[model samples]
Target: MENNFKMVAKTLFGFEELLAKELKQLGAQAVTIGVRHVSFVGDKGFMYKANLGLRTAIKILKPIAKFKVINENDLYNKVNAIPWENYLKSDGSLAVGATLNGDTFTHSQYVSLKTKDAIVDRFRDQTGERPNVDLRFPDLKIDIHIDRHFCTVSLDSSGESLHKRGYKIATNIAPINEVLAAGLIMLSGWDGQSDFMDPMCGSGTVLIEAAMIACNIPPNLMRNEFGFERWGDWDVDLFEKIEESLLSKTRDFHHKIMGFDKSPSAVEKATQNVENAKLEDFIYIKHEDFFKTQKGGEEHLHMVFNPPYGERLDIEMETFYSSIGSTLKHKYPGTNAWMISSNLEALKHVGLRPSRKIKLFNAKLEARFSKYEMYAGTKKTHKLEAKND
Candidate 1:
């Protein structure tokens, strides 16, 4: 238990609970949810597992020190006191990023620069050598979080954001973030129990994530690298053991996972991504206009997608959203459809009242994730109309 240390998994807004649930399911101890992040206690091997397995996490951080700082000099002193050699080599490259919440630090960039200077100064003073700064690919990635007078310095365990799962070499114009796609699927309550789909799937993110979730596949198994891989204490055998343990728990998913994109190019890219992920057997991608498609059978379908909300005009977007609503209403019965869009005005054109709506963000844009449940039969459709009437 002495080896167990606290770690934080950062996620998107509205995904804190999902990330916490993922950490708990992955055998984390003392899991607790915070704003856009989850704190958990785990050992080194468990930390590796958390980085590799969590679907909703954007990055995982291992806090090394937390102290109160009243000024920039105090910040430098606190950061410099930590043993930098323990995490990085004299010849290694490092990067520092900071997030400031209090008025004490008005500029996060300045804070990052100060932290970097402290680490480099320490190394230079002790060994006459210092790690160079490499923001793109660093041997050590440090994160500083300051809330009011409290400052927390942590080492980033996952690099390049967990959303870059390395399987998507090709993408559509507006491919959804892999983390957001997975979170949306989780929020939809789809556990690979029935047929799943992304009706407007672009580049197959949702499809691949669905397949991975259904089969218990570790999300970052295909990632090119993790920040810990470059650490001074990096252990290859321990990491391999954790990976094997995760692979051993993968369950078989029987239900079909399908994707539809109107654009042939998008479908091709999606298919390529699915193949890249080695999930082609579990996923099927088609270049068909979703508006024209109907439910293939009597089986219930679970759909999650993000429709286009780009530079199109209001009337066109309204028509598109209305078509989406109409397609689900008449053609796709016995289905639970979920969608996310930043265009609130266009969303009102959908006509059908959403059963549930949750506030979320699609990158920088504020968006709403809404669900529409269609009843099973023609009678239910008439009943729905009657209720609306």
Candidate 2:
């Protein structure tokens, strides 16, 4: 359609496919996956839907201009040539953020500052006033991406990252990012068909994300605002219609969603966050040491959690990981367990061999997301049974 424009949805490493899948499911066009990003075509309403419904995307950007620059001076000149008045009022507030992929632009901060200067200069020259830089609450947020000499300037449609789902008012130490949590759950192939659990649930992020995914609820439905909401062409009616459409598609989840934490304060915080997300009925948060508990019922279980590694890999972490393996191996039978941890040496202490291992990152630290399958009986017995079948 003529109204459709290109947009780039940024995501974490190893999540490009997940984001692309989400965009397609949300009705985006020409979906293409890139490293840590996905590009697609969509109308303004689809843009709003992408921001609200995408579970793995960090932010979405609508490119306004793309050019090749010889130097910073050329960048400034080209940026200044674009008409800023079309997007932002001369007296409005704005913010600029930049990313660089080549050695030509060694510092991202310098690029961001130059872009801001160019836009401000354009407004100042044409209207006798310029928008002030407001990093926190900007009326317009611009994103600059420089790959070698190529530059693409875009409007950030999602103001803050989409992970700020507005439901986590309280947090425990090392609470997982909501986008990453949701991606991990999808990667594990859980489709709301069976019981879900986070044994070491911190702040209940995983539990909340799992509940949302299970019910097909939009991840950002509770978000306070998106960058497009502050755009000059913001459409409240269209956005509301999109929201209603997403809500209409949400399905009821029959399986239980559960979380457990050893820390009382962590349990309290997770409970509060669950209540904040209005998922108390679907999600049950408990104060229990995971290692001491046994799996209940004969139904299958899907478990995903990120265990704490403290400051570094130490004796305690090794013991903690060993206990995790032992607990799953003995008590938590008939379960498919997944864990992400950056401590490679400590992970070796887990006696059970992982059925699958995928490289991922937790913040800046390189991590591995691994899966373990515990059978109802011994592995040998299960294998024999499978052979008979």
Candidate 3:
């Protein structure tokens, strides 16, 4: 209990509740939800579990200090006063990233530089040696967030965003981020109980995340490394035990998970990624236009995908979305179809009313995750529900 500390798991917008629930499920103490983040208390083992198991988190930060600062010098002095040796060795490398939400610190880069200088200076003064700044692969990654007059200094426990799940092969096809992909599936409320499909799957990120969720597999199990691995107090045995514990909880997924892409290159890439994730046994990929594809079985198919929003592709979005609605209404009966799009105007052209509209952000663009339910029963009932909606 004495070793426990407060940590914050950062997530995308509209996923606070999801992350909070995840934290609570993971046996975190004092789980509290904030805007785009959740704070909880846990020991080092729990921190490792979070970075490995959290599907919706982008990063996990363990705050070490919080103070009120009026200016840059005060910030530097407070940071310099901390015992840097306790976290990083004098000969180790470091990296600092900053985010500012208020007028007190308008420049994040300058603040990061200042904070880095303070830490190096502290080490130099104490031990006559200083840690080098290695931004690419730092031994210690620090995060500084200044919100209005309040400032937080935290040690980043998930190096390089947790979205880089390490299983994705580099490709030109821009897929949805892994963290966002997992969150979208969670928000859609799919538990891997029924058949799952990603109609417009680009790089198969949704399919992979869905399969992992269905089997209760840790999203970051395949990650190359985490920030805590390089920490001074890193315990290899403890981490392996946590990994084994998580693996033991994984359940078998009996339902089918599949994806379709019009582009052959996308199909190949998705297939390769699924293989890289070692989930080929669970996911099926095919090169077929989503518009022409039909739901295969009547096993309550659950669909989640991110369609092109006309930002990159030159296709007619209105017609594309109309085909989506048409396919769901005609061919994909008894399916709960959900898609995210930044183009609100194009979404209006889908022709079917969405049962639910969740406000979310895709990167910097504000988007909506819309749900359309196609009933298996009488057309009259489906139309009545649509009319009521």
Candidate 4:
């Protein structure tokens, strides 16, 4: 049998390219990008590596079965045929989830329930034993994706969402998701070459992720567990070797990675999170309002942050965004400033023209990530051309 198998990595919108690049760097083969996902071929070790290293992937799934279906019965029959015994024991537990674009399946929960029934019934009919359902920690997590009359059943090789990088225990009011934070940092093209800052550094997610990227630290090293750890063929020795090899490649990051938040509580939380990630030596956090701040030095500063999005309108968003624009233009010359916001109307108030803008999603709200280039000249008129007369 072929050790190489197909796997799909689900990602947020606009992160497909970043996820593909991450998979490619980690040695995945035949990588192809799909809408909100990327498929590739890799062995079990590669799967584990992807789980550990892919910064942009939300989850990794291994497709085991696919079939055409007319209705719920068809879905049930298709799910029942998969060899569940090979993946889990009769005493093992399972969780089932689904996505849909089919007429027969109106509710994802019902589809998930049907899929679970099929898996449990198969085991009961064969060995007279049924597995228990444990949604938190399942022996086999199954995914059902229905598009039209076609349904695909897959094993969730990633138990928890990959965003749970296991580094963050403390959080502020608006801590960014690990995957999204990493993706945003990578997209900013800050390759650990210069000083970095996250002004509204609630929980210091961006700072910690940036340090990890700068030092080449494996994101999942602190993870409590990986789904593949429960697999029968898990080779601890091989995994340890892989971990060691990756660790050996990690280089030291010398530049300062700093964070600033307005709230003292936020500063405390960010500092604690930084310590939890074992990165206190490389990162520094402080309590300060971003708008009132200026650059620490004359060096080029690379900043990536998610400022308050008027969640409660405590701060006048128009003034807040304008202050962000004013701070960059007046206080932060020689800096490349980037921010993401779900409040599109408020974003326009930041008058400095953006050099780049990308569409993204912050949870359920649509968001935009925009970049502003603040050149190192007083009353800077942006990057301009000399008049030739």
Error of 4 at 178 (Å): 0.6
TM-score of 2: 0.98
| Cα-lDDT of candidate 1 | 0.92
- What are the TM-scores, per candidate, against the unseen true structure? 0.95, 0.98, 0.97, 0.96
The segments of candidate 1 whose C-alpha lies over 4 angstroms from its true place after superposition are 311-315, 378-389
Q: After superposition, how far is residue 102 of candidate 1 from its true place, in Å?
A: 1.7
Stretches of candidate 2 above 4 Å error? 312-315
List the lowest-lDDT window of 10 residues for candidate 1: 310-319
Error of 2 at 362 (Å): 0.8
**Residue ranges of candidate 4 with Cα displaced over 4 Å:** 378-389
Q: How much does each candidate deviate from the true structure in C-alpha RMSD?
A: 2.9, 1.2, 2.3, 2.1
Q: Give the residue spans of candidate 3 off by over 4 A.
A: 377-379, 382-389
Candidate-wise lDDT, in order: 0.92, 0.94, 0.93, 0.89
lDDT of 1 at 194: 99
lDDT of 3 by residue, 1-389 (tens): 99999999999999999999999999999999999999999999999999999999999999999999899999999999988899999999999999999877899999999999999999999899999999999999999999998889999999999999998994534579999999999999998899999988888899999999999999999999999999988999999999999999999989899899899989888999999999999999999998887777668999999999988888888898899999989899899999999999999989998989999999999999999988888668878988999
230-348 per-residue lDDT for model 4 (tens digits):
77777888888888877887998879999998889889988988999999999989889887889878898999999989774377889888889999888998899999999999999
Q: Is candidate 3 or candidate 4 better by TM-score?
A: 3
